[model samples]
Target: MRALHAPTRRRAVLIVPGFEERKITKALAAGADEVVIDLEDAVAVDSKAKARALVVRVLRELDRDPARSIAVRVNGLATQWAADDLAALAEVSALDSVVLPKVEAAADLVRARELLGRHPATLQALIETPRGVQDIDEICRTTAPLAAVVIGYADLGAALGRGAELPPQRWAAIQDRVLLAARASGVAAIDGPHLGIADNADFRGRVHWAREAGFDGKWVLHPGQIDTTAAEFTPNPAAVEAARRVLAALDEAAERGLGVARLGDQMLDEAVAVAARRVLTQTEGN
Candidate 1:
């Protein structure tokens, strides 16, 4: 696969308390690019069924034109919550995707894809378990409506018995692994949030680390994290301007039917075209 970037807007997601219309509306108004009406961890186990019942109605209400896409992160199939989760999804037209937690292999995706019926709600395979990490590539590149592969690092850390840290922390390794798989397959990849909700410096550092690891965007667990994710993932103005130059050069070259060209003083081949067009696309999104 080739190196890649896309005209993606920042994917800052807020995990809201499920079964509640007010909380979902509040999170979206706070500027999260996507508000996840969570049926997984945020909803208590005792209230899971009640919460699941409200998801379809809540999504249909919030999922509006030019609004942030609504998603439901269903509890794992191994648990009691998944059956109703699938049922709620089948009833909703507003839901854009379903996030499957602790996905360990392609089979999990295959099951979710089947369970989603013929609805167009996409899949986001979350790689959080040790087995999920090991099977990251297989799970992420499935021939299904996989929106992106995401990481839940804090849970992953607990599972691995390690506190969160950067590179080589098993959590970071899997984050990169999932991103690599997503990029190779031309899908998207999102980084899990830094759990230090109050430690701004540390959280920003973690976001920076995720940026370098090739994650397209990140999960915004707290209200404070949303602005930072948007700022970091938005294409830099300088790069967007440069991409305009690249686009112009390509145009002139194409007029002469030339296969190779230069953007400013640099040669622009197929590889450069890919990277340059990404920036141009970014500019358009802005």
Candidate 2:
């Protein structure tokens, strides 16, 4: 039977090259809540077998708890390697999720479901093409076993040609579609990666943009990106303290049988109290 998808647990996910288990191990130790060992574009066509073997080995060693997420990004159904890839993945109990790259329709997920059988791992989609974006709604709403919808910035921009920037406005339609799909279906909508590998300032700006756009978090390539993404996505101490104050004042007011209250110069409402709780909850896994 199908199962509930694993929840997105971390403030950030580090996307590491699957063939390099060393890098994967380093990233995991470097504060990534999880790592996406990529076996597709990151691995050369000839090294697919090696990458799979490494990912499986890595999976065998890591904790698979939802709280300590570890996922694998495999080649799509169109490739000769996908079936074998799924077969290998099906054996690992340490896998929290399986990322399906370049999914264009629900049929991709159907094939994935058929392949996963009773393994019960969640499906995370990497939206890397216009077609994938066009069909993203049905993909996100297809029911359990599906988790987050991740944007694939580099590949998507390449797919759309030279005019498309890293975080292309050209694909805004698909971006909104993925967001609506994820939000409507109660899943996290993760933003794609930033190609500015060495520019910390630019990367932070891009991540802030993703947060503003309502993305859950970013898929990062470098370990340097993780702390920045996590810091940006998670509520800071000031915000958390403010939230705590809002809730505390409201609780005291309620205890005294007061229907409304004001915290300092600001008038507090149920909305403010809830916002405080939300800020705290957002850091649950951080």
Candidate 3:
């Protein structure tokens, strides 16, 4: 099996594990940066083994391209299927990562790594519980080989009992905490799916809010969401150009022994430089 690595693109979509080959193909063609074949909530209890076998076959077929970032969202540690799911996937060279759902503590990550047993597949934790949110900082610090972390808003909302009608500010606060934790740990921070699959305006609004909150990306639930999320996460051309100009201006100032520089009416400092570099990094190879 090839070594595991981080995904290059921003948008990631979750596909049920038992999807037909053609459906999987169409999803990949829909412009998702990463495709996660879900084995947890998406699969029926009795169909776990079958879904696992199908996922393995699909991953082997998809991994040949090398450019495709394919992941599997295995059942949580509390489930009977979680061990078998990891064991089965450990031998697949094409698997880039495993999404471990309901990660509430650092020990869960440790157990997952041990189950993976030297395989190159990275782990992306799904933070869905109140304990997971509270211990997020410690989880981030202790977990090794963690590629990214994503909010599982549906489960989290249920656990918190905020209901479907919770205020927007409440959700924003939760997302901000997850984002801060991921950023502090120097890993990708992905926002949860919007859940309003057919609501383009709602999707765009949520995507914009996530982008503005400094999230790396958002989960896409449908093929229709793929293009919209991908576009939303990608830095705009004007922003990219402005970032380049900031770098250039900083370089010129350094050459002239200036401690500070001005870009229009705004002053350029380390913070501005950092933001500009982030823009360039995000837009690389676009």
Candidate 4:
């Protein structure tokens, strides 16, 4: 199990409906770290087969880029279309991963792997229900090519009887738990999309909260949300410079056989150095 890191500067993820060809192309070039071609919620009941075929065709035709991830969100395991979706995707060499929606336990991942056969595409678990959230630790710990565990707020909120509209703070505790599990498992923890097209202020606030809550990235439904999401998740230039200075000071002190150092009014130790290093790491290749 290798540690999964954000692939793009924005650390933004965009999900394009599999049935929408134009949207797929737009998402791929939209500066998102990952673009998930959705075959689940975005497609209608009668369009599953057509969407799967279209997604496969699009994937086969697209140029593969190692720097960015291109994944497909197949329908839930229990759905009739999942098996066919997995089978069709098993041989798509251009795909980076498979987004498994509505995962409830470790068994769900196991079943998906079984269905996926020997395909090397990694798995991103979409935890949408109460059971999925409760068993998130186990899901994250599963040994199957797991890359990230994303929280799906729409279905989750509905399952929790919270209705369609949910405040960002309402998800704080759940976000913390998912982040904790992903950290322990050495995988990326992704926050779900805001599920709204308008209300730019509200969207920015939600993105800010996710960044502050320590999420590796966020799912953006529309391309317009990409820049804001990326900007908010990205560390400020001043902060990155400050972190570099702190690291430089700490490294110099260590070379002098000192375990601690002083930078202005702040005492720098291994703990402070650790935080600075994280900030610098986030800015890598920016």
Candidate 5:
């Protein structure tokens, strides 16, 4: 059976316009954990077909790194081009996953997989609309091989008619919902693309928020944002060491027939150990 987990870490996601072959080529070599060729918002309506064809050709031609995940963000399931996009992508064996935009229900995932035919690429859902967010629990509960769920912040904001600058608190609530559902379903949770590429300060703050809030990763629009995402998402040496200490403490407690232990000034329990192990898991291969 196909694995439900992602093939690699997803701390830094570099997404390029699918119609731009040069950009895609550059993205592949940009050292992001995942490179997504975007066929939806990034490509113009007239360029959709071209984007689809080019993405297939590029995936077929390039010698992809097995360690770095490669994905394609196809047009939304509601769009006219989605079926064709899925059908075309079925032939690209190198694809690790397909990011399905505006997924509102569990049925959408099943439909996308069917449209994709025999291709084994995993599905990543983009929750952009109110319906999508409302049905997120059901979407996550689906039996489909969903590797991750990403916040489509820009589109979601626009759809909610909240204008561009929605408050951080509101975004946090939405992100928490996505994160909770993803964790419960055992899938990765990704933050949406930060449009303020030129605003380094704001970008770094958002990355920090994502990390602290337990998001698996944040989307990095440019190579400049990549390093920041990588740094913030990757667990530091101290954190890894702390995780090891926590596990050791738990083991020691177990040997003593105790249900809890003390680590420095804090009390350690199974819950604490779970968090610590998660930190170490994030450090793997970093």
Candidate 6:
């Protein structure tokens, strides 16, 4: 099989489950890279079937473009509705991905793929529980067609008996593990949503932290967070130019039979070139 490419867009917004056509339309217009029609935590137990039906209809209508990158957040395998959810969505050819919640093992992803049948939808795992975190390496390595891995902070914090606010050091350790796991597995590592929606300062700080820690992007729960997330993930023009210079200097040095090059006062080598290439790749079309 060929390698899977990372998503070009950085922000993903989740719409509450069940039918809310107007809200979905507004979310798509909010400039998010993708819109996930959630059928898991957002939907109530009684509305599962209704939400499933509505998502199918929406997928059919939106599948026409295929470039819109629409996805569904299906219930976990342990739930009664999960099988039915996959069976129904399997027929939709336009679905770009499925967000599988409570994925604790590679088997969960394998089952999701089996139910998806011959469809082209990719799987994005939600690492929310302790088991999921512990088995993250195996889960990322074994799961095929895995596009991204997201840290569901709310559920994870709850599982760890952490309150609404987690200590910065503790949270950093968790985030770093997820980031490294995704990197080693060649998939995107997306930070979970920041619940402090009203606190712009806190939200921006979190976004900055995620970028510094090497996350590809973050989940945005509100429309207002879309631009913030996108801006944070985008490489600054100055940084991009500097990266270009690093590559140019390295290329010139290689031609001169030198293993290292000087960029300003700092020495540039293979290690620095890797980061420079990443900057160019991340900002390619931006």
The collision pairs in model 2 are none
**Candidate closest to the true structure, highest lDDT:** 5
For model 6 the TM-score comes to 0.86
TM-score leader: 5
Residue-wise C-alpha lDDT for candidate 6, range 1-286, written one tens digit per residue: 2112224554545444446766766665666776777889988899899989987886567524323457789999999999999999988766778899999998899999999888778899999999999989988986568988998988999999996356445698888888888888877888888776553887888888888889888887788787778778888999999999999999999999996799789998787897787787667633
TM-score of decoy 2: 0.81
Candidate 3 contains a number of clashing pairs equal to 0
Which pairs clash inside model 6?
none
lDDT per residue for candidate 2 within 38-111, as digits (tens), equals 88988999999988998888877775444557788899889999988989998887777889989888778878
- Order candidates by TM-score, high to low: 5, 1, 3, 6, 4, 2
Q: Which clashing pairs does model 5 show? A: none
Q: Which 10 consecutive residues of model 1 have the lowest summed lDDT?
A: 1-10
- The weakest ten consecutive residues by lDDT in model 6 span 1-10
TM-score of each: 0.87, 0.81, 0.87, 0.85, 0.88, 0.86
- Which runs in model 5 stand beyond 4 Å of their true positions? 1-6, 247-270
Winner of 2 and 4 under lDDT: 4
Give the alpha-carbon lDDT of every model.
0.74, 0.78, 0.79, 0.84, 0.85, 0.79
Instruction: Please give, for residues 1-286, the per-residue lDDT of candidate 4 as tens digits.
Output: 2212324332788889999888888788887778999999999999999999988998889875656778899999899999999999987877778899999898888888888887777899998999999998999999787888999998999999885457788888899999899888877788998889653888888888889998878998888888788777778999999899998888889899996788999998877776686676557733
Clashes of 4: 0
lDDT score at residue 9, model 2, on the 0-100 scale: 55
Candidate 1 structure quality by residue, lDDT tens digits, 52-160: 7776766556546454556789999899779778876887777777889999988888898888888777788877888888877788668787877888777788888
Candidate 6 residue spans exceeding 4 A from truth: 1-6, 12-18, 63-68, 245-274
Better of 1 and 2 by lDDT: 2
Report the lDDT of model 1 for residue 81: 71
